[model samples]
Target: MKVPFSPPFIDQDVINEVLSTLESGWITSGPKVKALEEEVCKLTSVSHTVCVNSWTSGAILVLKWFGVKEGDEVIVPAYTYSATALAVIHCGATPVMVDINEDFTVDTSKIEQAITNKTKVIMPVDIAGWPCDYDAINELVNAPSRIKVFNPESEKQKQLGRILVISDAAHSIGATYKGLQSGNLTDITIFSFHAVKNITTAEGGAICLNLPESFNNDEEYKLMKLFTLNGQNKDAFTKSQAGGWKYDILFAGLKVNMPDICAAIGLAQIRKYNDLLLVERERVARRYQNFFSQYSFFQLPILEDKERKSCFHLYALRINSISEEKRDLIIESVTKTGVSVNVHFIPMPMLTVFKDRGYKIEDFPIAYDNYSREISLPIYPQLTDDEVDYICTAILTSYKKVIQSND
Candidate 1:
């Protein structure tokens, strides 16, 4: 049996939604996009949400809105996907890479040390759908000592008087922390709807606005919508209305708006996610946990604890006491069995772009350790129980073969 990793869960419902959008004839940032944003708002309980073409776009838009510019710094985990750091780079700011905890989330303690007056934002990624410690992070930014060091250069920054927290929740839409959803856990959170994500719009994302009460999320939503459409006061949907043809460009903004056609796909998936889809994902993860626990070499990922529950986006299983070379060989062996797997990421510091920017992988030992041993297993709504069993069996057999050969 051939097992594919993380295929988008496209069904008749998704098809119908797309068909409906096509039939409507208004596909570009129309009612479907608005509806998808509303559904996300409901799921996350955030006051407002703005849909964008991609997570990177949403992150850049948010950073720009906060006035992050040259000489500014944004703190991010070295263990995350490159998009997190790339967003900061696009805004002409430096990405201060921090080490991650064993659970794969950013180390909050390490983050405090990285803070400087130039620090404008702290982007904590929910690696593998597990929520980070937002409470600690929020407190760290809001602490008097930290605030005293913060020298606000922009009007937006001065108004807040602290570093903004943006949750890179690309893999953790449904995840919960201390009874709060991932999107609502930070000052702002961005959820990805990429093809491989738990919720797919083919390629799309949403920015959940959960700023403090002093800030009007509704006004912020309007500004974000404008920013996604080249700073036009009116969107295509609104301009389609009679007498709305003429509009003003307030400022230069990125054209990263989500079209209705793409939003249709995610709308269908997210509507049923919490009830049926998410449950199945959790069930499959639990099965993997049960099967892998008996093996001495398997290090099961943390799915849940006393205060948090993951969305089970990626089943990042780690092989204990294995060198990076052995892990690659084991992956090769597993692939021969017709099972598709992947590594979550290589540390950002190890990547060419960041390496050239003076980042050393040695600075983030934990991030490197996590990346070396990590193997992301196939975990999605469509993966059947039998397929999962086959995958587990394939990995175990391949591991034994690789170990015996090396011995």
Candidate 2:
């Protein structure tokens, strides 16, 4: 009856792919990585994709590529994982924290208010695999008023003449917004293939490039590949070829390239993602909704609506009218029943690093509200129907106990 939270779905296909990489002798950032990038482009219909060691690395690379440097600002939701803000910090820029909407996506209205002359990028996170409002966001950035206020310091920024939008799509690889996939919905989108993600590469990420027509995506893809490999004109795989030993360093770049071994894992998973893996996750989420809806206290996560479809990465069930303390007690009770659960995140302002940097939880009221009562239930593809029922029962019983004790 034990229900673990978000285990990576590893079947025979994943194992065989990894085994093949190990046998190939070229297990570094080679064919497998390239293939995974291509597969991601095909799935998301993005023009170009660059695989990296992790989402943080990919974000930093993209931020740096867009000329985000010291004194620049990037707008991000306070509700997201720290990595989103940390990427901006690594580039010596500040993260302008904004609150989120009830659906767990960054509030577009808040983003518009946060924009300033120093704002270089707007990173909207897709919490729990739900896509954000890209159409509104895109229009906001491109609006003549916003562009007029933009101060471009670098050559790249000057070329674009406006703020950039990067989708923090770590949880939303398969999600769709207005019939377009998450990756294709933004100027650039980064997808995480972390261990617990819908598609796992053990530990990896991909940057989907869909810049405006003014910029060449194919050229940017070449530059991004070099950026991930220490700015070397040739990668390890290319250097392994005959007479390719000597190469030039274009500039100081990051060593964040994804190895073939890790890419192989995600490669196998994504091939069957749309048809099989994503469907099962959605099915489990629907079952949880069905079980929890009858109770007044249970608030179900929105899986889809008329405009968007989520990847159903996390079943972020919320307990209505409960204090944070009561939510903790309920989680404690549920754990005793052998159901492992989690909180999506603690607001950035509430965390020590951001707090010390002078951010206040009071500024992000909505983010705090969502964080307090949110409980991320397991919704992986491999979860069985029986396990889903057990998990729902455990939560119901635990909530009753906590309520009685508080009363």
Candidate 3:
């Protein structure tokens, strides 16, 4: 009767892959990692993939690669996990937080107003596996007025010629927007393979290179590899070759390379993604929607649109018109009933760190409104139908209790 939030689907295939990796002797960022990157390229239809230790690392690497530093600005949604904004801060750049739409994605209409000569990156997060409107965001970024506003600081930025759209697609991998996969939806997209994500590699992430046609992805991939390995000229795999001990230091780089061990899991997960994980997650989500639709208060997470489709990563069920206090009460009651639920996020301004940085919750009304009532239900490939029913009943009962108490 106990329903945990999200657990990695580690079957025999994952274990065997890891076992083979452990036996291979060359376990650190070697053949298996390369294979995983190739598989990701095939899955997302991107030209290059750079596997990293985490999505935060990948985001930071991209920021560094484009020479985002002190005084620059990176626009991000206020509703996303702090990683999105923290990536900007780590690069010594100011994170210009923007409010989100009702869909819990960045409000593209307001993006242009936030753009300035200092704006270098616009990171749109695909919250809960649902992709934001990339086409709209892209048009805004590439608009004539906005392009004129951009002032390139680095050689890489000048080459790009405009603001770079890096998708914070941490929750969306198998997702689609306007018939394009998550990676292809933006100029560049970073994916997370953390344990709770729809597809997991225990703790890993990747940067899908989808830069503009004028940019050389292959060259960028090579540079990223160098940047990730402490600015070393060669990785451990390359140095393992005979007479390859003499390597040169390229420059100061971040140590965020993914090892073969995590890549082993990523390979297995990506291989079986569409057939098993995606199907089961979608099935569970549909069942939840069917059951919850009978209630007036439930505002289900977006599953699909004409131009977009979620990977069904998280069922972010919302209780409309509820106060933050009542929402917490419902979660408490549901937990007592043996079903665990979690909020997708707390808006940036509400967080103590960002608050101290002069961001006020009142500035982002839409994001805070969504955050107050959102409760992410259990939706994973391993969840059973019986568990789904139990979750529904618990939520309904708990929600009614909170509503009646308020009345």
lDDT of each: 0.95, 0.94, 0.92
lDDT of 1 by residue, 1-407 (tens): 89998889999999999999999988899899999999999999998999999999999999999999999999999999999999999999999999999999999999999999899999999999999999999999999999999989988898888999999999999999999988999999999999999999999999999999778899999999999999999999889899989999999999999999999999999999999899999989999999999999999999999999999999999999999999999999999989999999899999999999999999999998988998999999888899999999998998899999989
Provide TM-scores for the models: 0.99, 0.99, 0.99
Model 3 regions more than 4 Å off: none
Clash pairs (backbone) in predicted model 3? none
Q: Which of candidates 2 and 3 is the stronger one according to lDDT?
A: 2
Residues 1-407, model 3: lDDT tens digits? 89999888999999999999999887889999999999999989999999999999999999999999999999999999999999999999999998899999899877878999999999999999999988899998888998898999899999989999999999999999888898988889999999898777788899999998888999999999999999999999989999999999889999999999989988888899989999999999999999999988899887998989999999999998898999999999999988888999988899999999999989899998999999999999999999999999999999989889889
State each candidate's clash count. Answer: 0, 0, 0
Task: Give the clashing residue pairs of candidate 1, or none.
Answer: none
RMSD (CA, Å), candidate 1 to true, equals 0.7
lDDT of 2 by residue, 7-79 (tens): 8899999999999999999889999998999999999998799999999999999998888999999999999
Q: How accurate is candidate 3 locally (lDDT)?
A: 0.92
Better of 1 and 3 by lDDT: 1
